[model samples]
Target chain A: MKRIKKLDTPPRFISWCAVGGYEEKNGPLGEAFDLCDESDTFGQKTWEMSEGEMGRCALNLALSKCSLSHETLELLVAGDLQNQCVASSVGLDSFGAPFLGIYGACSTCTEALLILSSMIESGAVTTGACVTTSHNSAAERQFRTPLEYGGQRSPSAQWTSTAAGSFVLTSDEELIKNAKLSNVAISDFMIGRIVDGATADGSNMGAAMSFAAAESIIEYFKESELKPRDFDYIVTGDLGKVGTSILRAILEERLPSAAGKHLDCGNLLYDAKRQDVHAGASGCGTSASVLASYFLPRLEEGEIRDILFLSTGALMSPSSVLQGNTIKGIAPVIHIHSSAD
Target chain B: MDIYTNEGKKEIIKKFTPKTKVLKNTLLAFIFGGLISLGAELLREAYIYFGMSEKDALTLVGVTLILLASLLTALGLFDRIARYAGAGTLVPITGFSNSVTSQALDAKSEGLILGVGAKIFTVAGPVILYGIASGVLYGIIYFIYLYIIR
Candidate 1:
């Protein structure tokens, strides 16, 4: 069966919002974020609770941006880096909508959107929401170490983003008119297969996840019969500096022309040298927040026409990493275009 | 597709991954670690000057170092120094204190019993287990040497 699916009458992303923490608020595209908490706490006593609050706030902002209520939300697809996806489930539980919790790790944003768009296209859901979040402290405690742990981070290690992103997608043109900004639509998507590059290092996640990104891009190019120049940019989720170069090299071998059009969410989120983020940023929020705040707005304003947004994720747990198992990478691409198309 | 294989990807990643500054890190670690040792020695000397025995002074110095490390970890300053210090902070007793204190602080949210009490030793557990185990093993070997070989 084909992994690429073209949505019939693409569902328009009517509203979206991005919420960020201290580091993210001071990032390069800091001002682009809709909401930010300087303390990174969001008034929550615990980091885990803070992460969940971010998801809740993001979804609320998204709904409010479109002037839509939770009742209108026919379906919700959400996930986060938390174990069993607790952040999204507990955070968004108050919405009381038909909810589906997914686990795509960092690829959650695109995966949620991909699933939501398919539901809308099938007329199974008229309105849906896609939300994902990640907090640096929470993720570090779960994946690597405690916040106060004094450990040297490798040069290839990436800082997890403490941010959240939410999007409201709808098939009804009437509701689309009520959206704060409505133009971009989900046109097509390709679900990536699990790929292991045999990288066992947890600190250097970009290396482990780059192969899956290459697979998605190469496969998309082959199936779509499109060149790099056809789209404004090809965005990858949290590949960082290391993974970006690796991806470019892999693309150069087969599709040399496609190498230069790449932009990694990890690279875009932080000023690596200035921020002292050795490699770059990674997490569900890294790509989700960037896309919600930066790319989608650009698409909506007609600044860019067509772009392929690829959300890449490394599918590995702490247990798996500790067991000397190789990290498995998965990336799913979403074809989002300006309504001008 | 063949080009995207694990072996091919590894070759590509090796070319792109940036090199770590081992020499620079080592130099920093050396300076920092040496400075920490010097401070401890001075503290031990100061304690001895106060009419304390050498053994008592040494014990007091150990307690002082542990208190300083724990305080820094609690104040959230140890990790910052440790970042650039590399193994400098880790090789010393300060590292062990920081590990235990940090773990305790992290799990403090889950409550004192199951949280801090249980998880306080998670990071330092291996070091402790192996340290004692190896010491016991060495003792057994020494006993055999004393009774038989000697």
Candidate 2:
């Protein structure tokens, strides 16, 4: 097949558990549209979900286990991985904390991290909550193939993990404050701008999304601002193996400054290590799982510190690239404080 | 209501002659169309009194009604009927059978393999499915009373 890579991410959270039950996504395009037309948000009505309505769904579940509320926080800055950034657009519902929306691709979580830390030190908000998620079937159905086409998947691709991931950005007081997080006073950090990353044909998403992972991470610490050794984990969303090695080499050469601190959610998920995926992770939920499931647990346990989390995204849209076009991409890097010990 | 003399009358006569929707099939359609339909309608009433199922009664009466239509179709009665009482000859069951069989006859010159052989089955697909479904449901009821009860 011709290498035609395109992506459109819907509002994403870190869990598969959130969307599947809302509607049974089945069938080909005409019928699926027919069913969803009467069903989920991707179903019947509007595309953008209010932050309180959606945020509370993900946060309320995580916070129920964490014991947090809206009053004790610093800032609630969230953005959707979807168009108009509506997925994370309405992040200002209940917590009353100042919120912001930024587009950095499926790499949105990292962008959200950059803002939370900025607010923490600038005295804007002591605590901050960062959230991002991508619905697999919803995102995929809207963007790529029909759900039932379960055709042969290329080794160059990674299975989009079904999960929603969220994190509490807070000071030392409470990790989750009223579902809003206190600022994690980062001892050392810098906001990294995307300069140069992978230029591989994203036709194989695993490769393309990973190229983004590699280039962004290398450009980040090299240009301004921080040492690679300053942080423990540098995670990228679903870069599987194809792009991970690509990311590793580019970083080791340019920013030999932080080679060992790299961690990629793409390659680490499952099949990314064995050159199994022709490309790497592509969806918003790809990193959503690792941030919420893998990284946050490690953060709470003090196993990692000075965390530098970045979700890599391929901003190639179907319309622009379909008619033979490519667009520039952006990745945001956030340096966070995990634990006091 | 308005009056017209020689020249105008000629144009009016030509217009009326071309557009007349006259049902002029005095034999194939008019007489048989009347008699067969009347017979089916009468038999339909008589059979219902004698306990004929609506489904079978519709089918039986339909065969007679469409027999009239197929004869009319064969004798070129339909082209004239197409002009008058527009769809009367088109509605009955025999009309559907007449459509397929007559088209087959018309295209028979194309050879049996391509025309007649292929034509009867052209309208077969949907009929096959509905036939199978109706037969299965009826068969199940027939079996329950005869085989199961025994």
Q: List the lowest-lDDT window of 10 residues for candidate 1 chain A.
A: A173-182
Query: TM-score of the B chain in model 1?
Result: 0.95
Indicate the TM-score of model 2. 0.51
Off by over 4 Å in 2: A1-55, A71-74, A89-99, A171-185, A192-202, A209-216, A219-231, A255-261, A271-280, A337-339, B1-150
lDDT of 2 by residue, A203-259 (tens): 444444433455456655555445677678776665555556655655666566566
* TM-score, A chain, model 2: 0.68
Off by over 4 Å in 1: none
Write the residue-wise lDDT of candidate 1 on B27-95 in tens digits: 999999999999999998998898899999998888998899999999999999999997898889999
**Global CA lDDT computed for model 2:** 0.50
TM-score of predicted chain B versus true chain B for each candidate: 0.95, 0.46
| Best model number under lDDT | 1
For all the candidates, what are their Cα RMSDs to the real structure?
1.3, 25.6
Model 2, position A196, has a per-residue lDDT of: 28
